[model samples]
Each structure stands twice: as structure tokens, then as C-alpha cells.
Target: MANIKLALVDDHNLFRRGIASILGQVADFELVLEASNGQEFIEKIPRKMPDVVLLDLQMPVLDGTATADYLREHYPLIKIIVLTMHDEDRMVLHLLEKGVSGYLLKDSDPDEVEKAVRKVMDEGVYLNEFVSRAMLRKMTNKTTVVKQSTLYNSKILLSEREKEVLKLICEGLSTAEISDRIFLSPRTVEGHRLRILEKTGTKNTAGMVAYAFKNDLV
Candidate 1:
């Protein structure tokens, strides 16, 4: 397979260069383009067409949010991975809702950066443990407009035990952690997780959390 082409867009010169250097050492990654701001990144998109873009939230010419909107509308296939200093739940949730492929703290280790990039490329989404829990908390905090009947009509009714497992999963617990808390074996916890996904028709953990909250299941 070809190396994954990546673009970096951040106004901080030193930080951008540092990441460029780090990505340069990776065998499967190529830093094909760098931009100081979102507008520059957008202008270069037609020519560079990177497989993934590591975007900073705050930039001079245009912010990451607007750039993300433009990209999602015009270039839906290009995956966006947010590399930002901010970890506020609202900001992260906003970007996730904008359809970003991944989220990572700027201070993350280089190996984690590479891992997130590769996961987003292969699995379509990557969220750090912190971000994932924050997203779930924020979702459950807000009230959804979808009626309960409309949301659950086609889905299997969740047993009380399954709801307990789903709640822990959304809390970002590993299978073993959940098992210890709930007095079930890890394999049984995994079974519950898979069943919850199937019953709710969600693709992954993030989607499962979203569905649980939107349906007021937790």
C-alpha cells in the first residue's frame, strides 16, 4: 500500500514544523503539505489532496470549524483529524458533529499521533479516551428532540443488565474494568457490548454512546 499522505494546518510555525519532523520519521506517513492557516490549506487542497489533514482549531485566515465545514461539503472523502490544544467538551463535541475523523490533544506523544492517524485511515474514526468520555457525557447532558418511541421502535428492548453495561462502556471503561465493576467476566461484558451495538444499530463505541444518550437509555 502507498504511504498515507498528510497535511498539517496550524498557525504556529514551530509546532507545525515539529509535527512535520515527527511524521517525517514514520515509514507509512508523508507530510505532503503544510499551511499556516485554514484558507491556505483550502487553496492547496486541489493540488495536494492529502489522505488526512491534521488541523488546529484556531487559525488566522480561517478557523478549523469553518474549514471543516467546507471540506465536508466539498471533499467528503478527505478525512480530518483535529490536532488542537483545546480539550473543552463543547469544542470537541462541535467538531465531532461536524464529522471529523479523529481528535487528539496537541501534547500527545508522537506514537499516539501516528496511531490515531492510522486508525482514522483504517477504521474511519479515532477518539482519545478523554475525548470519548467527554463526548458521551456531553451527549447525555443534552436532551434530544427525537421521541422515545421513534428512536426505539425498531430496536430491541435493552435488558436492565445490558443498560448497566452500556452505561459503563460510555463511561470509557475497558471490558475488564467493566467486568470488575459489574461482577461479570470480560468475555460476558464483550458479549453485552456487541449485543448493545446490534440492538441499537450503531457502528462503534462512539455511535453506541450517541445512540444511548439520544434515546435516553442511560
Candidate 2:
């Protein structure tokens, strides 16, 4: 398999180098570019299109949120993992809704960072304990209003099988695992997953999960 091409965008030189060094040790990871801020990263995207980007939220010129928005609009296939110190639930939800593939704190274990990369590649999203807690907390908040949209009306939009598949997905079950649990072929499970994404108008599984929680679809 070709290596997973990676780009690092962070203002902190020491942090960028530290992450680059760790990712460099992985045989399947290739550090293709490094930028100190979002503007520089956006400028280099045409020349060095990375499969995944480790982006920091706080940066000069342009921020991670803006960069992520640009990527979602222009290069939807490239996965983004927010590597930052912020652990605020609201920020995590905001980024997830914008279609970021993962969120990892800077103090996370190095192995977790590597695992997050692989999981996002395979599963289309990587939700850690922190993210899960954030989702749960949001779910329990009575004041949180569910965004009403025709595309996200669960009864009107999703079939029974699709709902089942989505619930399993939110439970962190992979395609094969969901297949086994639901007594369907992996290909069939993937079909359901894709249709669910389409009906929900989500960019990836992370976005789908966020939508599910917010709209009480799962």
C-alpha cells in the first residue's frame, strides 16, 4: 500500500517537529509538507496534496477552522485531524460539524495519534474518549436545539436498516463488525453507510455522528 501522505500545520515549531518526528517513524506515514500557519498550508495544497493533515486550531494569518472550511469546500477527500491543546466540548462539536475527521489533544499519547490516523483512514472518523464524552454531554443538554432540516428528519429520511447501521456506526463498530452484528454482508453494510451519509448530507462519519447526536437520530 502507498504511504498515507501527511501534512502538519502548526505555529509552534517545537510541536510540529515533535509530531513530525513521531509520524516519521511509522512506515505507512509520509510527512509531505509542514506549514507554520493555515495560509501557508493552503498555498502549498496544490503542489503537495496530503491524504491527512494534522492542523492546530490557533494560528496566525488564518486559523484551523478557516482552513478546515476551505478543505471541506475544495478538497473534501483530504481528512483533517485537529491537533490542539483545547479540550472544550463546544469547540470539538464545532469542528466535528464542519467535517473534521478527528480531534486529538496535544497531550495525547503518541500511539493514540498514530492510531487516530489509521482509524480515520479506515473508518472515516476517529472519536476518542474525549470526543465521546463531549457528544454525550451535548446529548443530555435540554437547552440544545436540534437543527431542523428535511435531509435530517430520521423517520422521513432513513430506512429501518439504515437507522440500525447508523446506530452501530455511532457505537464505533466498523463495517465488518456492523455486518456481523446485523447479519449483512460487508458490502451491504457499506451501502447502508453511504446512503445514510447521503441522506444526512454529512461529509464523513464524524459529521454523520455529530448530526445523529444533535438531531436525535441515534
Candidate 3:
């Protein structure tokens, strides 16, 4: 397999170095770019576009939120993994809605950082426990605020098979795993996944999961 090019964008030099060092140990990960802030990252994108970016939410010039928005608009294919200290539910939900591929805390285990990079590359999203809990809490709170009748009327708008696939997806199953469970070929499963994404109008799994939770589809 080709090397998975990665970029790190954070204002903290020590933290950035630590993450770079951790990811450097992975055989297939190549740290191709490093930026102190979002503007620098965006300016350097043309030189060597990475397959994934480890972004920080707090910075001096152009924070992670704006950087994420720019990348989603201009380079939608490049996966973004938010690596920051902030774990607030609102921030997590905001980034997910902005189409980030993953969110991780700065204090997360090194192994998890490596895993997040790889998973996002393969599955297009990586929802760790922190992100999952945040989504659930947000969903639970929203359920109480929104009327049950309104929530029920927001139709799923998915076929039965598609709904099955989506449920498995929201459960964190991979395409291969879903294929095995549903007795469908991997290619067919991928087809179903694409259809689900189209129907949900979501850019990636993170967005899809967020949509499912917000709409009580899962």
C-alpha cells in the first residue's frame, strides 16, 4: 500500500512534535506537512496535499473551525481529524456537522491516534468513545426539547435494506463486517452505503452518524 500522507496543524510546538513523533513510528504514515495555524496550513496545501490532517481547534490565526470549513469547501476529499483539548458537546457536534472525518482529544492514547488516522483513511470516519458519548448526550437533550410528535414525523426516508445498513453503520461496523452479517458482497455493501449517504445528504460517516442521532433514526 502507498504511504498515507498526513499533516499536523497546531500552534503548540511541543504537542505537534509529540504527535509527529508518535505517527512517525507507523510504517505507512508520512508526515508531509506541519503548520503552526490554519492559514499556514492552507497556504501550504498546494505543495503536498496530505491524505489526512490532524487539526487543532484553538490557534492564533484561523482556528480549526474555519480551517475545517475551508477544507470541506475546497478539498473535500482530504480527511480531517480534529485533535484538540476541547471535548465540549457543542464543539464536537459543530465539527461533525462541518463534515470532519474524526474528532480526538489531545490526551488520547498514542495508539488511538494512529488508529484514528488509519480508520479515517479506510472508513472515511472514526468516532471514538468521546465523540460517541457527546453525540448521544446531544441527541438525548434534543429529544427532550423537541416534541415527540415532531420527531416521529421526521420520516426516515430510507428503504428497509438501506435502513439495515445504516443501523449497522451507526453501530460502528465496517463494510466487510456489515457484508458478513447481512450476507452481501463487499461491493454490494459499499453500494448500499453510498446510497445511504446520498439519501441522508451527508458527506461522510461522521456526518451520517450525527444526522442519525439528531433525527432519532438510530
Candidate 2 residue lDDT tens string, 77-119: 9999999999998899889989999999999999999999999
- What tens digits encode model 3's per-residue C-alpha lDDT throughout 1-218? 99999999999999899989989999999999999999999999999899999999999989999999999999999999999999789888778877999999988999998999989988998988998898789777864537642654365477888889988998889999999999999999899888877877777888987777766777
What TM-score do all the candidates reach, one by one?
Answer: 0.70, 0.94, 0.93
Clashes of each: 0, 0, 0
Model 1 lDDT, residue 125, Cα? 64
Worst 10 residues of 3 by lDDT: 144-153
Ranking by lDDT: 2, 3, 1
Candidate 2 runs further than 4 Å off: 145-156
Task: Show model 3 residue runs off by greater than 4 Å.
Answer: 142-156
**Candidate 1 residue runs with Cα over 4 Å from true position:** 139-218
Full-model lDDT, candidate 3: 0.88
Q: Which TM-score value belongs to model 2? A: 0.94
What C-alpha lDDT does candidate 2 achieve relative to the native structure? 0.91
Ranking by TM-score: 2, 3, 1
Residues 29-124, model 1: lDDT tens digits? 989999998899999988889999999989887999999889988887788989998988777766665678778898898999998898777756
Report the C-alpha displacement of residue 168, candidate 3, in angstroms: 0.6
In candidate 2, what residue range of length 10 has the lowest lDDT sum? Answer: 145-154
lDDT of each: 0.81, 0.91, 0.88
